[model samples]
Target: MDNLVKKVKEGIWSGRTDHLENKESFRYHQIVELAQLDTLDTEGKACVIIGFESDEGVRRNKGQIGAAKAPNELRSELAKLPWHVSSEKYVVDIGTIDCTGNDLEKAQQQLGDVVNQVLTKKMTPIILGGGHETAYGHYLGVRNYIGKAAKLGIINIDAHFDLRPYDEQPSSGTMFRQILEQDENSSYFVLGIQRYGNTQALFDKADELGVIYICEEDMHGEQLVQVNKAIEEFFQNNDFIMLTLCTDVLNAAFAPGVSASSPFGLSPNTVRSIIRIVSSNEKTLSFDISEVNPLLDENNRTVKLGAYLVNEAITSFLN
Candidate 1:
């Protein structure tokens, strides 16, 4: 586990110090425990934070290459938020799975191993990702924890279907396709799909695979009622749910620091509502936030927004 994960640095959690002895004034940095994978132990409900430090998948998919730096950047932003979780619940940071050179597959497998360990201990894993490819490893861990017989429903909030073929190699765009083709117990439901973001062939592939999707345009105004109904139905059908958020699913104006920017993507409020709805569910196993490219951000706007969204998930899970 040590070889697979590099422990988080203490400095990354530093922030405003306000009454460290008082729980009422505590912030995330003041309460987050740093632990090692081999020695992790918790007596109460806990959420473990793990980072995937690689953009190899994005690079392979012919996208930008700077998402590798997102994990720590997000950590820095998250350190300052107010900690509102119950006293019985805890949050721990166990560090990251580093992808050296071009060994993306190995890194992803390492992430899966760590995630499996976290879940085995009865803790929720809040994964900060290198790319959308992080979903494959996230899925692997959840599937392993639950075994092969349980039905796993994946809820992706993204603008693209990401159903591209991976004949030669697996990339960020090929994760869902790989899962659907190989895992019969798994099902997929995507929200905020942009009509112009994906090619016609991809749409045909989604149809052939029997994917459940809602267009981005149909998710606004009063149309959300029908969307919520579909979400509820999806939850009822699957035995377990795993939620993944691709930062690019948000409008580029609000989230410019992603590998694939969506000009007509969902608003932050809408995305937050979905995160709350999904993460708070008793059957949802874990959550991952991917594709936040700090290198492309303007004045740390996107990173801050990503941190807030992650906080929303943590609060929902812990409450």
Candidate 2:
């Protein structure tokens, strides 16, 4: 753990510190506990924030590379949000795992170890990511905690199938294919897939892998009822579920700071509903948000939006 994660800097959590004793006056920075992974206490009813600071996978996949900066930027934005959960529940930041010198594989393994430890402490892991590759490490931790016999369902809110082949090397685009082909106990259900976002070969791969998915165009209004039904069925089938969001799944108009922009992606509200539903479920074990690039953002729009969405998940999990 020492080789992988560095404790978050104190300055990263700074924000308005009003009425130190009043719960109502609290902002996230005021209430969040900062701890080193090794010294963390045995605490339950808490959500631990782990940052995956790596974009090597995105670079390998031939996409923009600024997602490495997302973890702290998202933290800065989250620092100002009002704290609404009960006082007994906690939010803890355990710092970040950096992908130094293109060692994404090592960083990912390190992330998996930290995540496993967080779960072992009986806390929910809310991972802020470097790229969509974060899902694989997050998956590694969850599967480690639950054991091989337990069925794990991965609920990804994204525009691409991410089932691309990784024969040469694993990139951000090949995580799901790696998991489905390697772990029979794990299953995947993706929402907000775009018709043009993936190649026909990827679609065929998704089918071959028996993936359950809902296209972006069919995720709104009356159609949400059926979507909810599918989500419920997925929850019932798996022993545990892990939720991941790739910001690129949102319409480029709403989220422009991602590796891949989706002009016809799902709206923020639509994505929020799915996060709320999945995070609130008892079967759900962890949550991760990926591909938020501050370097490409419009006046921090995507970073702030990502923070709000993360708040939604944390609030739902604690409440």
Candidate 3:
């Protein structure tokens, strides 16, 4: 273990490779370096990527367990990104957070540790995922740092609202519900939600809770400008914002490796556009991208797209 940790450290700081390459078993290894809690700017701000591998809820679906390997797959692709983009320095001190044996309690605690450290230094935390159920953990990190009374909020870009009732036990689908229930003033705006998969029960809960829901069909033909406007409105009153990108938000053609592959959703271009608009705003406190099941991926397409999203996050931050 000592020798392995030494070797991993050497590779991360070696600077020969533009990015670090990783895999499922090796994926968590990359995260150990990421969780070092260092690498912040003089102002103590940095972007942290926490990639988790637990898929407890997805165990029921054979295809979903494969998503556990996504973060490792994404590392390889992200390393190849060009350094010089439009003269702004894309200096992301990337790292990962290890998942805790699919234990939600331990996982959230670990997540809270990294998130608290980042926020304490005033750095942004860009979390990758174990599952969207991590929203609860991620939000705990935010609310812990900013305090719940500060009007904390989240922005989800995906095909489902994920507001299933607490009785069902939280999955990727029930994270948003758990988040909103944390506080009534805690606002959550979900974009690109497909009208189909969401049960009437979920919709009713959203309506009663006053969670903002934007259907994919309604936004399908609309310009990126229109979508950005709505996002801006939802975020206008919030003090701290957590951004979530569920791969299912990308049209199946672009992101087919997800557990819940849906027919209709935003094009990669639209996803890019939304990411740019939301991330560029200084209000963003932390972010996460979830549900890229590399096992189901074709030619590593989903990993490449996940890498692309990281690039967009850096570019958006710098711009």
Candidate 4:
């Protein structure tokens, strides 16, 4: 694990300032850094951000290849944002887990170890992703920390169900399926599933696996009341909740940097509301935003949106 992980480079915080008298003063880069993932001091902190800098699973899944570049891009953007809150305790940059020689499984295992380390200390783990594959790795860590029988529920905001079979080897498209196959106790509820994005076989697989999902239309229409009710019930049944947001779930105009952008996708406003609702609940444990591919992006829109979502979640978790 040590071989795969590296401390966040010092220069990532270059834009920091000490002008405390300024009304909109502090920024993210000003937050403290941890020497290592396990060395974090969670005394006055909301969460620690850890990056997974690998996209090999995307390559295996035959998606766009550039998602591997997302984590650093996210950090570069997140570091520049001003921290509006007035507290000394802030998020810690716990560095990243890089996949060397395209060894995806080892990287995910390393990630799982890091997530377990974070959980035991009672601090939230905010995993900045390499791909949707990060979701599976994040799940392994959560399951490891809470146990397979811990009544953990996963809330995924994605355009596709990502429950494709992994008979051979798992890839970005088969993470949720991998999770379900590994743990029958898994309860997953996917929101923002695009009707056009997934095939009928995948939908059948979701049903076969007893997965809960709401298509994009169902999430936006009057059915939202029922959707919230379902989500509330799911939350009540679970001891802990893990959240994952796939950038491709947003409309292309809002998140063009994703591996696959949706023309008819959920609005960022709607997604933020969901994040607020989910994070506000004390049961939510860990979170990650995945599938940001800047090589395909216009400007830095997707990564900025990813930072905003992380900030929103942290603020909700803190307050």
User: What is the TM-score of each predicted model, taking all chains together?
Assistant: 0.99, 0.98, 0.84, 0.95
Error of model 2, residue 44, in angstroms: 3.6
Q: Considering lDDT, where higher is better, how would the candidates rank from best to worst? A: 2, 1, 4, 3
lDDT of 1 by residue, 1-319 (tens): 7678898876999899889689989999988999998888867999999999989999999999888899999999999999998788989999999889998888888888988999999999999998998999999999999999999999999998999999999999999999999999999999999999999999999999989999999999899889989999999999999999999999999999998897898999999999999999999989999999999999999999999999999999999
Summarize candidate 2's per-residue lDDT along 1-319 as a digit string, tens digits: 6557888977899898879899989999998999877777775699999999989999999999999999999999999999999999989999998888988888888888999999998899999999999999999899999999999999999999999989999999999999999999989999999999999999999999999999999998999999999999999999999999999999999999998998899899999999999999998989999999999999899999999999999999999
Tell me the tens digit of each residue's lDDT in model 3 across 142-189. 888987578876888888887766574556667777777768668988
lDDT of each: 0.93, 0.93, 0.68, 0.85
Over 4 Å off, model 3 = 1-35, 38-45, 60-63, 85-95
Local distance difference test, candidate 1: 0.93
How well is each residue in 218-304 modelled by candidate 4, as lDDT tens digits? Answer: 877577788789889989988999999998999888998899888999989879888988988989998998999989988888888
Provide the RMSD of all predictions against the true structure, rounded to 1 decimal: 0.8, 0.9, 5.7, 1.8
**RMSD, model 1, all Cα superposed?**
0.8
Candidate number with the higher lDDT (1 or 4): 1
Off by over 4 Å in 1: none
lDDT of 3: 0.68
